[model samples]
Target: MGGYLPETIVTNDDFTKMVDTSDAWIIERTGIRQRHKVAPGQRTSDLAVEAARVALAAAGRTPEDVDMVIVATTTPDMPFPSTASIVQQKLGTRPCAAFDVQAVCSGFVYALTVADGFVARGIARCVLVIGAEAMSQLLDYTDRGTCILFGDGAGAVVLEPVEGEGTSADRGILGFDLQCDGSKMDLLYVDGGVFEDSNRIGKIRMQGNQVFKHAVHKISEAAENAVIKSNLSMADVDWFIPHQANQRILNGVADKLGLDRDKVISTVAMHANTSAASIPLAWYIGVQDGRVKPGDLVLIEALGGGLTWGAAAIRL
Candidate 1:
């Protein structure tokens, strides 16, 4: 996996200058110290392309080698041409299947699941799955509840078919579970959109307390389900890479899974929440620091704005 964060950094003190918040108050509540933001005129596809190039290089592949591009993002560069298409064009990849999956924060896993189906069925040979977000552009900076919890970044991974024995001992993605509860959409969502407010873009709006409660429960449940589906147990998981939503929620899910806090990869303090990008970003950090490695059993999970939640088990 390869990850990219913009050059700009936004600190908690910066929020104090814009809203009725403080460094201490923000840290005490969200455990976020700083986040990165894109420069003016930088688009989400820009981040995605940079990350994708890194991933393709790391995988020893060229743009023409990719047979499909699936971008998981809520903040698309445009409504007509999907961000995946923009990324493909920017990367100079050949004509191939390109699309976007908008399960909000659960997007990466959702896209991965979709890609798994294609590769498993021999429909695509090589696929680029990216979770990129320009979340800062969607933030209502005045709303400390939402603004402080997001950052802009992109992460990408290349998935190719790895023949296995059809067992949990498989080399690649072993199993996954995707879920959503539309009834709880109001718990976390944007206030405006193309169809909702005269084609106006909206800012993030969330009910912190309620989303926190559900995140802990739903994220844990989906993770456990994925492990079981893979014919494995939590004890078999070497690393717990949950979404970087909040430190409190991350710890809560780890506790519920009985996972050692040290085994959980967390980047929320520095990266805050990158929505769909969180898992791959955190995974990239772990790999760079020598924590995550090939053949390690990993559990991934996330909860997003659609009230969507999902998990996947893989042997990386």
Candidate 2:
């Protein structure tokens, strides 16, 4: 696993001058003390390539060893020549399948699930799954509601096939439950796109209350389905690494699942919400801090724009 956070640190206290918010209010509401931002000229793929390098190194492999690349991100370097392809070029990987998955915040898990299937089918042996975003580019800094909730960061994991009997007892990517309800996509979205008059990326907009309501239920439902699919239950899960959307959503899901607070891997306090980058970023932190380790039963859940929500189980 690997993660990369930009060097520019923006604290809630710093926002006092830029927006109508206080340190206490931000913390009490979102549990985010600070967030990172990319400097001028840095693109999403820039952060992504750095993250991919670290992930490949941690796995004790080189870019040439990569058989496929899948990037999960909402903010791509551009709309064409997929971010995955750009990463491949920077990483110097050989020609192989490369693409991007844009499931918003649930992207990493979605990409991980896809890689798992590819390796399982013997189509690829070593696949790099990355969740990266330069979300600061899309934030309206004056909009306190959305600006305070996002940060710039990237996380990656290299998935390799571990031959098994093809059962729930597998060592990697044990089970998955993914779902999306697009009927109400308006609750959280950006205000600009290709057809928009603004050449720049659009700022984020969100209905906090509506998103909160769906978050608790969808997150819990995904986690429950994932655990069941793994032939296990909440009691069997050793860790819950959820998207770092908000402290309240994380806590609510934990309470609903009857899981201990300590067992949850949360990075929102420091990393804020890096959209799709949240999961692997949190997972990397958990591993480094010794909270998650080999043979651990890890459950990851996320709810993102597109009203997408899902869960993935892995026996590390």
Residues 1-316, candidate 1, lDDT per residue (tens digit)? 8899999999999888899999999888889999999999999999999999989998999999999999999999988699999999999999999999999999999999999999999999899999999999889978878889999999999999987898888888888999999999999998887779876679898999999989998998999899999999999999999899999999999999999998999999999999999999999899989999999999999999889999999998
Residue range with the least summed lDDT across 10 consecutive positions in model 1: 192-201
Candidate 1 overall lDDT versus native: 0.94
Clashing pairs in 1: 295-316
Candidate 2 per-residue C-alpha lDDT over 57-155 given as tens digits, one digit per residue, 9 for 90 to 100:
989999999999999999999889999999999889999999999999999989999999999899999999999999999889898998899999999
Give RMSD (Å) of candidate 2 vs. truth.
1.0
In candidate 2 the C-alpha lDDT for residue 304 amounts to 93
Q: For each candidate, give its TM-score against the true structure.
A: 0.98, 0.98
Best by lDDT: 1
